[model samples]
Target: MKVLVAVATRHGATREIAESVAAALGTALTDAGVRSQVEVRDAGLVHSVEGLDAVVLGSAVYLGHWLEPARKLAESFADELGRVPVWLFSSGPVGEQKRPAEEPVVVEDLVRRLNARGHRLFGGRIDRRTLEFPERAVVAALRVADADNRDWPTIRAWGREIGTSLARLERSVS
Candidate 1:
């Protein structure tokens, strides 16, 4: 089985999340005695979802929306994605306030459209120094603090679950 772990990120935090997921999934699949390959790439670099066993696509959320590249990928491959096991995740929500209580609106819609089996909303990180002027201004205006709120254990567990599910699927087919 081959799994593509694709992500659309702004300022790279979301990409780190994708890497963690890919690592955990690969380890889980190996532990399950499943022969599998996992590839992590930027969502924009993925031209197609064809010839894949499963996909774990994620994006960074800002202002209740997913990044355009991730949304475009899902929309372009809706048919192909619907046929395979796909999971979606978003890295957003920083600070103790975690202002955005709801997941990105795009994720909910994509889940229905693509039949994604699972979706996770993970806490994100913010480093004011890395932000562009506009982004920094917005963060200051919102009174959001710079912090890394990602939960490594929870992220890994989610990836492991997906790996286990894929292993079961592979066993059934074999």
Candidate 2:
């Protein structure tokens, strides 16, 4: 099986999250005794989705919206994505509130368009040093503190679930 894990990140935090997810999926698939390959890429850098079996796409949310590149990827690949098993994730929401914020309006539409198998919302990270002037200003305005809220266990467990499902599909096809 071939899986693509794509993400759109602003300040690298989301990229790290994507890496973690890809690694977890790879590990799970391997543990299941399934021969699989997973590729992690920036959504903007992926020009094609051909030959992929499944996809896990995620984005960093800002002001309750996914970044433009991630949004464009979903819009441009809607038809192709609909043919495969796809999972969506959003990494945003800082501070003491660790729960995932609501799905962005555009992302909600993409979910329907792609008929995504599932969507998960993960907590995000905020680093004061990484913020540019405007981002820092917005953080200050919102009183959002610097923190990393990603839950590794939850992410790994979800990856395992995806692996299990893919393995079942692979078995059924054979």
Candidate 3:
């Protein structure tokens, strides 16, 4: 199975998460007696899913919303994705906010409407120097610390779940 893991990142944090997910999924696929390959690509550059058996689309949260390229991909491929098996994930929420700020609006809602197998929120990271003035100030005022909050074990488990579901879907198709 060819799995495409596409992500939009501002400063490479989300991209790393996407890569980790793909790696975990690839391992699961191998264990499931399937030859699977996963690739990490920029969200905007992904124009086709012709040869892909499954896809995982993820984005970094910025002010409670997905990045522009991530949103564009969903809107552009909504119908196609509806016909295919897809999972969505979001990476954000660093430094413990009152409300889990990483909740992505676009992908999460679309997953419900599209009947996607799952939608997950993976912990994310924020580098203080990467932020713009306003964003930096907001983080500072909110006392958001600069740290990498990605939980690898949790992410790996979710990826394995997705892999298991994909294997099931493949069986159903056969």
Which candidate tops lDDT?
A: 1
Write the candidate numbers in order of decreasing lDDT.
1, 2, 3
Clashing pairs in 2: none
lDDT tens readout by residue for model 2, 1-174: 999999999899888878888888888788878899999999999899999999999999888889988998998999999999999989987877887657766677888899999988889999999999999999999898899999988987887888888888888888
lDDT of 1 by residue, 1-174 (tens): 899999999899999999999999999999999988899999999997888999999999999899999999999999999999999999987868543467788888999999999899999999998999999999999998999988899999999999999999989999
lDDT, candidate 2, residue 81? 98
For model 3, residues 39-131, the per-residue Cα lDDT tens digits are 989999999877778889888887778999988888888777777788888887777652254456676677876567788887788788888
- lDDT of all the models against the reference? 0.92, 0.89, 0.82
- Model 1 regions lying over 4 Å from their true place: 97-100
Candidate 1: clashing pairs of residues = none
By lDDT, is 1 or 2 better? 1
TM-score per model over all chains: 0.97, 0.96, 0.90
Name the better of 1 and 3 by TM-score. 1
